[model samples]
Target chain A: MSLKSNVIGALILAGCASLYGCAGQHSEAALQQAGADFQKVKEDSNVLRIAPKDVIRAGESLARADRLSTYWGSGSDVVHYAYLSQRYSEIAREHTTQALNEERAAKLELERQRLQLALRESKLLSVQQQGKWLEEQIVALATTQTDRGLVMTLGDVLFDTGEAELKNSANRVVLKIVQFLQLNPKRVVRIEGYTDSTGGKQENLKLSRDRAQAVADVLMDLGIEDKRIQVEGYGDEYPVDANASERGRAQNRRVEIVFSDEKGQLGAAR
Target chain B: MAVLALAGCASDPAPNEQFRLTEQALEQAKAVGATADEVPEMKLAEGKFNRAKGNMADQSFKNARMRAEQAELDARLAEAKVLTQKSEEQVNVLNTRIVRLRKQLGDAQ
Candidate 1:
């Protein structure tokens, strides 16, 4: 019975020796691979900076694996420690990458906010410049200052002949006038209309009054107070040119914006 | 006394705390959008966690502890990867907005 037990023990030992022989070779490759992985992560400055504890753990696991590799019939333990070392190295790299990405995102977010603020300031400046340009255009249009006041003419081209409705072609001039009025808030204006001698006196009077009223209505629609405007009609009485020629008659048919003084005192109607 | 010491050395206590910790790590990974379908580390984590649970049931405390520890790290790696990807997307979004703002400022000038 003792001889039989010894034979059985020897057979089991032989089987384990063969199994360990195969496992030893496999674990050697695993250890080398884990060591290479750990070395890569350890050498990376970013990994070391961001995940120092994880790097240390990887080194410890690699050391344990190296110690176990020297033991007989302990191939699985060596492999396990090697795998843990590799995992630690991979995790360290992942943590480093995440930290770096977060840092980049924070910087990008700051840059985005700064650019947005700059764009808003630039847009506001452009609007202010545009307001100044419109003021210049209004001043140029009102260059004609007669005995009546600062007279800005709305020519016949702004409306169809005999039509009181202002045409879309007058939008630019109307917008400029609105802006000018808004800037000079205390100033008032008298809108005077005139017609040529071709029409009957009563009909010409009504048409001229309607045309002047149309301009006042536009000013009010554009947010100018109605109390700041005065409308008048002088039909066929005030002719700037002779009615014998079509060109002179065309010039005679007009609406004029007469600006008040800075103190809101407007000139008396003609 | 000798028999008791021999028995103590022969078997390990149950790794209940390690199991809890590993499960928490897996939950954290999932919360951050890490999925086995996308991240191989998540797959490894889940597989190892399941094997650890089986080892626990079989009273293999040593194997259970080892698997649970590895699984925890795997889950942590997966979570980190997903967070990094999200941060990368945020940086890209910020870059696009900055570019648009720059173009608008240039046009304004």
Candidate 2:
């Protein structure tokens, strides 16, 4: 063979050897990288516990890459297998992250629901306790719990025989009512005044109205809001006792206070 | 010659599909308030997705595929972050409501 032709042949052989060497180095590097990625995924605590299936797949892909690298040298198949192994490891990591996040989210959701239930229970207990307290206060005020809410009666002794001004003895009962109203700002009340059938109809009605207004004025002065009180007079109407006897007439001449329901709704006076 | 042959034969159309999927994922994350609550992760996802597109334009199919995969994962993480933050806000609002209700009960007592 000619010297120049021999030199050309040797150069081609060198180029082929270098190309093969480069391919082998590339495959070896890929395999090493894949092994490192798989080891990283296996070492992660969350991935090990929550992503077992993905970890196993990554392990299997890594094993396949190892076998392919040993059998195929620097072939494209070994590089592809190594790349697949790396992808599998990354997928395992992603799955682990998603699982951990979902677990944390679920825990938070459960905590929120628990807090909601606790708040609801506390609110219910508070309402029940308030209801019991209100009942006791009404009882202390000498009131009756009728369908028309709590009704308390003040006899003629609480006022002068012919005047609308409240007597000194009426202060205690009025104070009690003011305290109850203060305790329940949402509760409204109505003051109803009544009288026996002795005076002229107009004069009796005016006296009754003036007496109801006097009670309401005292309540307003004691810090009760004016909007929470209604005043009315029913002269000799809906009497609780017969007005023929003196005792019955005394009973008829009285003031009645009616408390509203929980919603602050008062019923019609009967 | 072998390098040319390998490039011509092994060029995958899969990177195109992966790029499209990553774009869709980013769009979905943004639609769900990811930009507001998950700004850092959303930005990372967008950056990686844009880089993937640049690689695709440059015909670096392998780099494009890897970047697209990473972008998809980041976008998914952003979506998860947005959901978690929204739930956290709901819990805060519920706590405030409970406090107000308790105050009303105290006032009544």
Best by TM-score: 1
* lDDT at position B68, candidate 2: 81
The sequence of per-residue lDDT tens digits that candidate 1 reaches over residues A12-94 is 43454465663356777777788778879878999999999988898888777666665565566668888888888988988
- Among these predictions, the greatest lDDT belongs to 1
Candidate 2 chain B lDDT trough over 10 residues, lowest sum: B1-10
lDDT (Cα, tens digit) per residue for candidate 2, span A58-146:
66765665554443233455566666666667657766666666666666567666666766777778766766786586676755677
Which tens-of-lDDT digit does each residue in B1-109 have in candidate 1? 3453345335778989988999999999999999999999999999999999998888777778889988998998899889888878887888888888889888888
lDDT of 2 by residue, B1-109 (tens): 4675457436756587888888888888888788834467678778888888887887777667767876775676677667656665665665666666656545644
Q: Lowest summed lDDT over 10 consecutive residues: which window, candidate 2 chain A? A: A1-10
**Candidate 2: DockQ?**
0.17
What DockQ do you compute for every candidate structure? 0.44, 0.17
Clashes of 1: 0
